[model samples]
Target chain A: MEMTMCGIVGLFLKKEDLRPRLGDLLTDMLITMTDRGPDSAGIAIYGDEAPGLKMTIQSETPDETFAGLGDALTVAVGAPVPLRVADTHAVLILPEGTEAAARAFMTEKGIRVMGTGHAMEIFKEVGLPKDVAARFGVRGMGGSHGIGHTRMATESAVTTLGAHPFSTGDDQCLVHNGSLSNHNHLRRSLTQKGFPPSTENDTEVAACYISSRLAEGASLGEALEGTLDDLDGFFTFVVGTKTGFGVVRDPIACKPAVMAETDDYVAFGSEYRAFANLPGIEDARVWEPEPATVYFWER
Target chain B: MRTIDMATTPLRDLNSTLQAAAASGEGQWEIVNPKGSHAVAVGLDGPIAVTIKGSTGYYCAGMNKAAKIHVTGSVGPGVAENMMSGHVIIEGDASQYAGATGHGGLLVIKGNASSRCGISMKGIDIVVHGNIGHMSAFMAQSGNLVVLGDAGDALGDSLYEARLFVRGSVKSLGADCVEKEMRPEHVEILRDLLDRSGAEAKPEEFKRYGSARQLYNFHVDNAGAY
Candidate 1:
């Protein structure tokens, strides 16, 4: 019951002009779903990419922890690490191939790595979803695609890290709206396969599972299909890759999902009510996706 | 004619006024800017005619009685759920479980209906112009489900007495549900239902499917299969 009550929202833009409005559009959809999950909220935005690796890290004490952090990291990695702070989370654009070195450096310095990719930046916190989005200024961010989650927190404690939109692979992440009964068993197998979950949250296990499959040369659609056969329990997973987003639901489809596709964008929500305010929504082709089927759109 | 703009009036207020109109008796209402709000025009109990402008969220016209509700756009899940008596028409597609567990009503969907359409319906008459999803009419007790298009996997599993009619192909029939002989009475019923629902198909194009009555009573020998 805890897992089945979260709200998931995704928007993948097909037009470049709509890219700047992705975060603003998604924030409205996410806040409208505050009734579904109020324990925690998280958003993963695939914004414009530069020629470097971007890593988002979080800290409880930001001013003290972030001051002089970039210069020190730049010197340690022998490359410039430009950091942009957004409240509790900070995005660091590091030089190419410095992700592994920077991750280890952050671990030693006791900073939690939220996510790392060429474009993706994850921001999450434990509070009302509306407040969380405002604190991170999510509406001001821009991207081509993004996924957001408002968690009810049935299985784990309501903390900053125990939110949805778990990222395990580079330029990849996942947000879920249901619980996995077989997560404990799957976690063991996934850990052995070198995609160990960083959190006790069952959703992270599924995220790690996808990351592992993608690492083994599986496409996003194939990785989603694998979940239907291997994973147990109810889920509606909306995954994010470098270029696009994918959606898949468990065979039972206990969790509800609705999708809308227009010429400009493809939108996914836990319910149609989430899409009430989108532009050109009336002209979109709206329908509920079938169970155990994989739907993905790429640029 | 009364016009209620949902953009200004809250959903709770909209529903209350619609429901309160039952005491004032029959009237015509037009709701604009519905914007996919949940439970709009629900619990209405008069001979009112409500025409909603846009798509609606969950449970629109739920538990309705005597009112005629029409939506110009698609509907979310559980539309007309547990309806006692009314006429509900959707101009576009319907989400999962359209007319679920309705006791008595006439539901017409001009477009497709998703999974579990008319599940557990008691006495509702449902007609879909397009396809229905898997596990439809599951454990239904009594009703009539008519689909002009195909039905997904496991059409009417564990059914009892509810008559199923399909003009197109059915992927597979559930346990204890089989294609029965379409008699003259069924053809007449189908003809009237199609006419009333504004479906274009002929009654002879349909095939009837219903319960074998094997799963009705729990017998010691039929515990596993039934």
Candidate 2:
């Protein structure tokens, strides 16, 4: 009933050279949660891609299609973005100035786009770490702070959309483990709050719920704490932004989350192996987050 | 017969020696003073008896095939992860996720075992003489998990294809989990398993816990709850 492993990797690099290490470090971190998820893998990387904000474009296939209007998307985004079309995914990296227009244009074009501070690249095809890593080319260009998902495919169908690191309409994304018993109610509430719901996933509802609160000028910590009062369920989620990260466990705390902190960086995961995988942290002091406690760290 | 003093031997050298001993078809092997070392007797597949004199670390007898392993002290996470077949007897407390995803084997923990014991177990018999932590036998595919002591909260959460026996109080049941009537057949099985493990408790004292068949196959009715 409960998902065991969840992970988040954030690094404030002493030097720019340390950024590349995030790939192998994230690979090691994500692989440790293999028991939690064996179906697909995805990562959201935020590095030197663009100084300004980036937008997330989500699309599906068959009935909800968007691949037909590639030319319109290119002009609207104002960039000849590489469109990696899977059965369900079609993405374009919009520049900073065009983010709002791109969001609106994609909305009219029937493509769901949200602005996120972190550049998210999600790849989900069945394979081992090497094959998955090759698809996103994460072998060389790992970023400073990234979150990964390895899903066991319990609640929702195993698809790239169900893959985590769900982005809000702004520069925030979230990855979650554990089921939310009250996702339906939360989704209904979020829709009433003027937030458009995309996936049928409860995690997406949670992402939007938090994002809507943040849009009301709430701090990340305030939004998280506020959700605890309203949202009900068992979930341990790690939400990431460009300059900050936050982790919150459900009130019941059925899920597991361990954190290791050093002077330079912070790492948290459902298991100890993720912390063990980070370099320059051969002896990072690790501890588990208490139940109902929300932790926030800003770089 | 063979004996390796782990106090002076590294795990790499000692594991090789134990493998050699098992390949030699030695009836008995002893690891004296195996203090907090990890991966002891892992993947050993032979008709051999191993006795680890002290505490061990994670995956102590992981993926074991035929050998019978005895740990004299506490064991860390995943004491027998994915073990194929064998007997692992723990004389002391066990840490988290003990016997996780094991396919086949008999895990006898004389002392308490921590959470997620026998999680996703396919075909195994785990006998815990002391209290068990939360989520014991979670999502177990097929196996017999016998607990002689009180079980912590959420026993047998989302359980499947597993038979569970607990002699003491159960804190709570997980999603789709329930308490079943302990039939005479279950009592017989428990008796036999306890006899084999040399446990003193009687089978009649134990209660049975298992899946309620609610969240077995994902129906819309049981969505989000699991």
lDDT of 2 by residue, A233-260 (tens): 7788888776667888775565656666
Which clashing pairs does model 2 show? A117-A171
TM-score of 1: 0.97
- TM for every model, in the order presented, reads 0.97, 0.58
Q: What lDDT tens digits, residue by residue, belong to model 1 across residues A1-299? A: 24758899999999999988999999999998898999889999999896798899999999999999999998878899899999999999989878889988998999999998998999999999999999999999999999999988766678888887899988898999888889899989999999999777888999999999999999888999999999998899999999979999988776889999999999999988889999999999998898899999988
Candidate 2 local lDDT, residue A232 = 78
Best-performing candidate as measured by TM-score:
1
Which lDDT tens digits does candidate 1 get at residues B1-226? Answer: 8999999999999989999997589899999998888898999998999999999988999999999999999899999999998899999899989999999989999989989999999999999999998889998888899999999889989999899999889988888888999999999989999999999999999999999878776788867874
Error of 2 at A32 (Å): 3.6
- On lDDT, the leading prediction is 1
Q: Candidate 2: which docking quality band? A: incorrect
Kindly give the stretch of ten consecutive residues in candidate 1 chain B with the minimal lDDT sum. Answer: B217-226
